[model samples]
Target: MSVVTLIGAGQMASALTFPLFENGHEVRLVGSPLDDAVIDRLREDNYHVNLRRTLHDGINYIKCADVKEAIKGADLIVCGISSFGVEWFADEILPILDESIPLISVTKGMLDYEDGTMQTYPEYWQEKLPEGSKLRLYAIGGPCTARDLSDHDPSFVAYCGPDFETLEWIRSLFSTDYYIISLTKDVVGLECAVALKNGYALGTALAIGIKEKLGDDGIDHNNMKSALFQESVKEMLELLRIVGGGVDNIMFAAGDLDVTVSAGRSRTVGLLLGKGYTIEETLEQLQGQTLEAVVIATRTARAVKALAKAGKVSIDDFPLLMHVDGLLNEHATLNIPWKKFERHM
Candidate 1:
């Protein structure tokens, strides 16, 4: 049992404290500046308002001001913040971080450029540090959701870092029967696969949303849903090849898509859009929630356009993602682009 500190008291980060507390680690849940309300709730009642559950007493809740003291001797530091908080984390947390303390992130996202280049969250964080820093970066990927993980459900996820021994040690800090972890060194592949799934999930839900919108209680759109799933995986495979990631992590890609479509936040956005909700209307409905899918959809679409311009890849290969981008940004409706799929084989 080591001193495990999780920064950012968001849903996923707060939920992850379950494993750390259950494993008998001296866990510190540090709330970022944005999580003042969450920290207050935890301190007052050991309850996470978002998860709507009471946590164990073994955990220590710290506020943003006391973050320096909370991470004083933490053996393992988990970057449990979302992608949007990376810049803040870098500015506030990285400067005081010890290079020796292992850093693993629960953040799932990619930094895409117009030149067809992409970097995982860990890599992006590494670039923020001064050159020659020994701060090792790791990321968690796959289908595990905050709700499932918080409920102690059996969730499979991949932990990608550089060293096997170090990754195993990090896994030892939190890994339990229900919180299963698979180790891999393909950091780029794992991150790309997982982050890409967020966008595709919206498309998957469009199938369901459209069917439900028609008031057709007679038939289900599982066939269309499955087709979207297959096409999403295919585009993911093409992306892996383009972004210099391993194509063998197909399970991570497909598994994440399945899980997100099943219960992830992106599913809700997709459903609303599929049901003929306007982009502004859908966003207004989900105002406070973190819209990872919306951000990724637009970014992925831009990346594809950039790549196509560079003659690196064809934009036609990613019809689902493109349609998602159009749906969210271009105010395009739920046109599934069924004709664009299965053109490769």
Candidate 2:
């Protein structure tokens, strides 16, 4: 069994750790110093994951006051922190990580302030690790949710890495009856697909809500919704293509369309926004964590513009780019003519 060290004791971390423990792998879990209450709870519970139906136990717990002590002898390090916290963790924790240890990043989303760069969790850490370190980086993405896995339901996720051996190793570590893990070699494309799917989901939710509000007193609402979804998918695929992603990434992102467009935390946030809720108001009402898609939409709008100017893609093929640009610029009342968009096609 591989010795695994997981950083961040959030929902994702909890879901991943339980499987590792059940597989007989020695697991060490580290939580942020600021999360004293959660640390206390984990200590009291003996690092058992109380999944409501099943209790998973025997994982070692460390209340990380220092980084070196947390990852001294770890073979594989899994990071489940939020995207915004990546840089901070890199600076504070990754420097102490073992040089030969392989790393897995489950976090998804683009860095909005960083020129709209879409980086997976491992990529962020690789940038911070020692220059000559032989650290291998891997990424995990797909439609799987923490709640589904915790409930012992089957869910699929795609894992990709530059190293085939490391990819296979991670796949072996996480695979279970409830969690299906697949390996891939398209690391860049995989990460980009994961980030762009969120923007498409938001767009899909908004279009659905708008269609419902338009009072379908005789309109082909179903066709409109279908067209909107297809167009959004195409737009995302095109955006990814312009940024050098592969067709397989597009296929994987589309295959996982069920969760993105269906009812979920991110889609619900989009629905609320469609109903005219301000960002802050929507966040408050949901009482849930915000997905990085909101910022992604804005950055994607900028990226589309750059691509169009560079002739990487035709503006005529994606009129949504123009609409998104206007939307991001706060000109919310503007609309693109269907004929103009169709002409480009």
Top-scoring candidate (TM-score): 1
For candidate 1, report its TM-score: 0.98
Candidate 1, residues 188-256: lDDT per residue as tens digits? 999999999888898888887787798857877688788888888889999988888899887998999
Residue 72: error of model 1 in Å? 0.7
Q: How many residue pairs clash in each candidate?
A: 0, 0
Q: Candidate 1, which segments miss by more than 4 Å at Cα?
A: none
lDDT of 2 by residue, 52-124 (tens): 2233667777776754676877788888776667776788777777767888888776653233344555665
The per-residue C-alpha lDDT of model 2 at residue 259 equals 71
Root-mean-square deviation of Cα positions for candidate 1 versus the true structure, in angstroms: 1.1
**lDDT against the true structure, each candidate:** 0.88, 0.69
